[model samples]
Target chain A: MRKQHWIEVGVGAFMLFGIVALIFLALRVSGLTLDRNEPSFTLTASFSNIGGLKPRSKVTLAGVVVGRVTDIQLDTKWYEAKVTMSLEQKLEGLLSTDTSASILTAGLLGENYIGLTVGAETDVLEDGDEIRDTQSALVLEDLINKFLINSTKD
Target chain B: MIGLDSLARLGRAGLALMAALGRSGVLFFQAVWGWPSGQGVKLWMRQVHFIGVLSLIIIVVSGLFIGMVLGLQGYSILVGFGAEQALGQMVALSLVRELAPVVAALLFAGRAGSAVTAEIGLMKATEQLSSMEMIGVDPMRRIIAPRLYAGFVAMPLLTAIFAAVGILGGMLVGVDWLGVDEGSYWGTMQATVDFRADVINGMIKSVIFGLVVTWIAVFQGYDLVPTSEGISRATTKTVVYSSLAVLGLDFILTALMFGRI
Candidate 1:
């Protein structure tokens, strides 16, 4: 009877250990953050096309990640991808009203993200400020088409 | 006359193979149907102890060693390109996506699967199975079902433990042995790995592998020929077939899950 009870307890321990391991694996492999610790402020930007830009894509200034793009919506009137990003609160003084935002690719084949080039201006953009100066993603097909047209004419 | 005899022998082999497959299918369902009986609970517990609890140490030790090797190799390779910060991503992705499920299942088959086959084959050779049948006891329900069920239940959990332990092992080598920044190791991993793409699919792979390997192992045991040599041969076949099936299914399952097949 004691041996049977020990087996039962061992089985129970195995099951409990298994559950803990599974949860740990799930959290680790998913890249889900344990704490939402970054204090951030939201801003909007308009782009003609976002290409492969996603909601969780990084937002960078001078190649340093300062925020994450949170929401992307289609602007029906402008016919463009309107992106909402949340930046770290520390960048408020550094970015001006005239900052230029471009959808940039990381390396040759990396994921798409938002890159900011600061412009010279005294007025800092406030909360909910829409970035007006922007550049869209470069589509390879369109560039090829333009190149073909120019080459044929020449 | 010789040609006719060889053709007849080939036909008989084909018929026997089909008959074996059909009987295994019936045994699986019969066990499942008989699962609600009172003794079923006790039998399942015993099987789980045999299959799962006993196999824990080997699985954990192997997982750690594999992870350490991955860490050491990954660090060396990435050091060349100065992209060693991505070491966490490499280890986690490899473990969750492929290695953990496939390797652990292979090991399980060699250890638990061979044990299962030998036990069942011994019973058959000893005439215990025949005696049980004479007494009108359904041996499939009593013997085969619990073992099969326990395997299915225990496999995914074992696989998850393997992956987690492996990642932890990678951390030890990457952080302590190689002196990688601890924060970056975990941070890069968190930033890159996607839950649906890596973890869920990995767990699914492990479960399917468990089902396939266990099915082959139990079937090989239950259908063993009644002889000493036959019992030994069946045990060997269980290991061999389970390993082949796990690897082959992993390739097909991976393509289906990851590649748009």
Candidate 2:
């Protein structure tokens, strides 16, 4: 019985260690970084609907994550979700005065993401500037319900 | 007159079946909820020792091989499309969403479920459960509850083990074996695969599967006759029912989550 107990303990310890190690390795390999190299700037995007949008969501420009959503606040003035994004230093120069931010899907049924369309204007938008012309995501369920409702009328 | 009597008997039978099902459902929930009490904790730990710790090596080894195979297969397919970077996302999503939970549940049912059925069957044969009842003890709250709770807790932990090991296996093939850049593999996964809902869905499925497997095993065991043949039949039923329930529950969960018909 003593021998059996020892064996059990050994096995349990090994499994616990192995699982923890694997999770640590996965997190490390996934490039989950906290250190910032360049001066970070914040910009706000207001959307009528930020469906399932949460802080720490990636802010993508041309499908690449340039920053992350830092804060999401309800704008009482406009009754919209004001999403504040922290842009990485390297991508700061691309945020022009005419740049447009839109809430879009990564793929069909995928999570909602912020997509930045680089503007042609030469002047870069300063920090804290709002990207006012933002498009909200077209929720698929709502669209389907609308289509079904509309089609029944005819 | 005879036809009317027969109709009444059929209606009574239907009502009985409905009552049995309703009682089982309520009992299952109560067992699950009452599992965190002091005695329940000890039972849960024992189950963790048996199910999670005992099955770790097998789960990890299988998970690693599955991950490696997925990486090799995904790499080949993506290379054909000239999109090798997507391999990480493919492996991560498949492992987390499907393979890990199903495989872990199947293994748990076979290893732990069978043992539970046999143990309870032996107790029933020896009149141990009857003795408990005579002594004013509730077997459902005491014996069955702990086993069910243990299973519920163990399944998710085991699933996590499977997912973690599978990812490592993919990383080994993508980085060390195939000479692909480690950064890109991890980068693609972080960018595409890791979602909050994926983890939640996996855990929820695992917990439900665990409860079903344990409940079926205990129910069969408690209903077993005293003969050796009855024990054998109980064991067989336990495994068969557990596996079917796991698969059936997985289908329901997947449909509900993805909202596909």
Candidate 3:
């Protein structure tokens, strides 16, 4: 009976240790912060071309991550990509209505993310408001083609 | 005449293999027909202690060493490309997505699976299982079901532990010894390794491996011929078949989950 009791304790401890390990894997290794419930608001941007931008890609302000791209879809009527972003609530009333959004690539051959540049207008954009100014992803192929054509003509 | 005799032997072997597969499938269903009741829970715990707790040391030790080796090798290779920062991503992804579950399952097969087979096979060889049958107690219910349940629960946890420990080991080597930037090591890993795709898929693999290993172990034990040589053969078969099944199923599962088709 005593041995059985000890075995039960060991089993219980082993299971508890396993759960701890799973939580570590989820939070630390996999980087699942589970912070989606934090206060944030949605905003949208339209781009002619998003390139390799994906949902969950970081939205950065001056190289600091301020939000994440929550959804990306094509606006069939406008014939452009509609991107929805969730920003920190602390940024509310800070970003002006005329702020510009551009898809930017990280490093060379790295992932593409959204970069935000502040605007000077006093009126700030609110949740679900779409930014008007946008720059499409710079396709390297297009740049190479133009460079090759200009050099050949010279 | 010789060709005919060889053909007849082949047919018999094929029939035996089919019969064994069918019996094992039925045995799995019978063993897992329902959830454990009040008294069955204790037996389940005991099995967990026997199988899971006993196997922890091997899993952790091997995980640490394997992770350190990955870190060392990854750094040497990535340094040439000036991509040492990606070491964390490489280690975590490989461990979480593939190595942790598959290696842990193989070890579990060798250690716990073989042990379960030998114990049950010995019981059969000694007529203990038959004695329980004569006494109106179902050995399958009391003995086999609890072990199978414990195995199903233990495997995923063990795999998780293995991944967690392996990551730590990699960090120890990559960050502490190798002088890779700690922030980039962890940050890039976090950015790249998706929780749903990598971690959850690995967990799914572990669960499937658990089912295969335990099912093979219990079936091999129960179906063995009641003799010393039979028990030895059953134990060997448990390890061999469980390893093969885990590896083959891993490939199929990986293709289904990550093939993006």
Candidate 3 wrong stretches, greater than 4 Å: B1-7
Displacement of residue B93 (Cα, Å) in model 1 is: 0.6
**Error at B161, model 1, angstroms:** 1.1
lDDT of each residue in A11-59, candidate 2, tens digit only: 4685576457435434643344456455788999889999877887888
Best by lDDT: 3
- Worst lDDT run of 10 residues, candidate 2 chain B, spans B191-200
Candidate of highest DockQ: 3
Question: Higher TM-score: candidate 2 or 3?
Answer: 3
Q: Which consecutive 10 residues in model 3 chain B have the weakest lDDT in total?
A: B29-38
- Candidates by DockQ, descending order: 3, 1, 2
Name the runs in model 1 displaced over 4 angstroms: A33-56, A59-101, A105-110, A115-132, A137-154, B1-9
lDDT of 1 by residue, A62-153 (tens): 99988999999999997988999999988876689999999998766567999999999999888899999999987778989999999999
DockQ-wise, the better of 2 and 3 is: 3
User: B14-111 in candidate 3: lDDT tens per residue?
Assistant: 99999998999888888997456788899999999999999999999999999999999999999998999999999999999999999999999999
Residue B251, model 2, lDDT: 91
lDDT of 2 at B92: 82
lDDT of 2 at B61: 88
Candidate 3: pairs in clash? none
B3-94 per-residue lDDT for model 2 (tens digits) = 99999999999997787567667767776666557655655566667766777778878989999999999898888876786788888878
lDDT of 2 at A41: 89
Tens-place lDDT digits, model 1, residues B1-261? 999999999999999999998998987787667673587777888888999999999999999999999999999999998878889999999999999999999999988999998898888889898899999988888888888888888999899999999999999999999998888788888888788778889989988888877888888888888898898899899999899999999999899988872
